[model samples]
Target: MAEFSVTLLIDASTSMTVTADTPEDAAELAMDEAGNPSLCHYCSGKMDVGDVYAARVYDGDKEVLDTDWTAQQLAAAEKQVEKLEKRVAELEQAEQDAVKVPRGLLECYLNGGGDWVEAGHKLRALLGGGE
Candidate 1:
């Protein structure tokens, strides 16, 4: 059996310290402590024993537990990022295509031709709005 220091956090402003042989024992102690009616330090309502959540455990200055996301979670996050990036790239391509003027319209605009009114309308439609 190893000595464990547990920090029991009931809410944002309430916490207590207790020592136990193991983290599990510490958690149990915390639950028991929270069940006590007098130990309700922050809330006016009755403290539910289920609300006694263990925030962290440590052995001296070193933390002995892992509370981070698992490898599967990290992999899923990476896949989501990839999917979002691909969607962004597709949207960027669509925006580029939308802004692209037809070669004939470009030539007509540059040449100052008689079909300027029709070319301007085509340009406005391609750009999604009129200037």
Candidate 2:
């Protein structure tokens, strides 16, 4: 979801780096690049040992070191989204209820010089008032 720039310390000696969407992606890229046996097979001499260590991870300007919280974060985000959706639905229902006056009553009220008391009686009657 976000781009990360990772600086890896290879075998505690050389610097191997990669930019990816996640820290896991960066680690996989570093491992694939450093641990490939084909390069050693092609060369006559023995290859140096390399172990990938993620030295630093950056998401834009902020530094991110903890890469194990993805599942927790996703669950939290899902809950927030669900809450927002329910709030939106409640707001929509409130809006609909606010404008639920009968169309004929509204037309008559608008045409009859805005009679507030008569419109109020009509609205109360439409809403099943005893009076």
Candidate 3:
């Protein structure tokens, strides 16, 4: 068994906000069937992995509050939504820029042998796994 290191570059920033959602639908669409919804290596966030809902949506969009304030007659709700979309994109890019994952360091541990299993076993032991 080879030695491995785990390093996490978690953001301790106060401006960061995270949210999770669970979609009721899992039915594969035509694009999904054809692999159109591809997993983007660079675009992926920390919340990407275990999400039943779309993580990219949250990463790229701002939260619209439930309020009585209405969209103007000229700009419309669609325009507001569009503005939110743009904000989300900017935020997602900034988030990616702020945190850098050492993919090579990860590859060393993952591609090297038995590291994942060993780590899991150790965690299980800490959580009361018996001999």
Candidate 4:
């Protein structure tokens, strides 16, 4: 395998309980208390998260693939989020529509090789359910 350089970034957050006069003082106090994190029980929400952000492939000191994976991944994630949100909204609307549809109609629709989801939308439209 060719040697590749990869960069990953992690962001960690730890909650600390400290008594201080100002925000700066609190930060300082937190650091001072950080020596023994286990001693603090009141602290909460300790989290560490990271994502692979970049990679580089080199050929004899010449850079070949220098890519910002972070940008690409973020764009992809945004698109997925958009799609998921739309799907969730559709499902929720269908759930509401299901309440309006008669059981017989739903049974017939399903038995006729119609998916419940599409059936919900079409049935709702025919039933004069506004939006």
Candidate 5:
């Protein structure tokens, strides 16, 4: 069966009364054997809303995957962000390098852009790929 998590919040005030199937079943079993149920009238009378409580039943913690797709996607996005930052720095430095040379040379280099070697190098360093 699939695992599931169920959180039940119960109010412990005078207006609310919480009952569980296990206790009710026990009471029924007592009634079947004896003339009266497992609980006495005094037991029911003493019951107060303060006895109410929140119960949680976690059915799927062990069977579920540790990391979901969203977590993987978030990690991928972090990598992409780092890569983009490096690319931006490379382009900025290239711009500074271009300023030192002739406009024509800079324009030519800009127009005929090569591979993303410079940006990739920087990103690789950021990602611990070494120098």
Candidate 6:
């Protein structure tokens, strides 16, 4: 990431009346009046801004920056996030439909005092193999 400075150019219209003997003095007074102003009855204090907007950006090396760089990064990031979210949904669905057949058969034979031969027959039937 780099640093940026943004400057906005606007237009402000104003008028001032000054009492001076010479035109040069009046010009000087008008220039000075630009910085210091009072709200007048006829003047609206709001600044007028046009539709056009522009920004000049430069890095530390005085190099010009590519404006589309951030947009490209955002598009790539969105694609990656979509792929990961799809894979996560697939894993969650598989977990919900999974059956622990081997563990269940082992527990039935060893813990329930059921015979292994009978358990094998049942396992075959449960797996859709012919008994």
Tens-digit lDDT string for candidate 5 (11-96): 43121122335534433443334432233577656543332222222223422111335655777999999999999999999998
Separately for all candidates shown, the number of backbone clashes (residues 3 or more apart, or on different chains) is 0, 0, 1, 0, 0, 0
Model 6 C-alpha lDDT per residue in residues 1-131, reported as the tens digit of each score: 99998655654444446666654565456556565444455543543334312221233345232224565577789999999999999999887656467776786578546799878777667778857
Clashes, model 3: 1
lDDT for residue 113 in candidate 1, whole number 0-100: 62
Question: Can you give the lDDT of residue 65 in candidate 2?
Answer: 47
Overall local distance difference test of candidate 1: 0.63
- TM-score of every candidate relative to the true structure: 0.34, 0.43, 0.22, 0.30, 0.29, 0.37
- Expressed as tens digits, the lDDT of each residue in 1-131 for candidate 4 is 79987655444445435566654465455555555333244433343334333333334465444355675687789999999999999999998867765874686488658877666666666767742
lDDT of 3 by residue, 13-128 (tens): 11223333421122222113333233467746432333222211123464332111232333477788899999999999988855533443344356557486555554444446
Considering TM-score, which of the candidate structures 2 and 6 is the better prediction for this target? 2
Tell me the spans in candidate 5 whose CA falls farther than 4 Å from its real position.
1-66, 103-131
Q: How far is candidate 4 from the true structure (C-alpha RMSD, Å)?
A: 18.6
Runs in model 2 lying further than 4 Å from the true structure: 1-67, 101-105, 108-114
Which scores higher on TM-score, 5 or 6? 6
Quantify all predictions' global Cα lDDT against the true fold: 0.63, 0.63, 0.43, 0.59, 0.47, 0.59
List clashing residue pairs in candidate 2: none
Worst 10 residues of 5 by lDDT: 57-66
Candidate 5, residue 91: CA error in Å?
0.8
Write one digit per residue (lDDT tens) for candidate 2, span 85-107: 99999999988887786664686
Q: Rank the candidates by TM-score, best first.
A: 2, 6, 1, 4, 5, 3
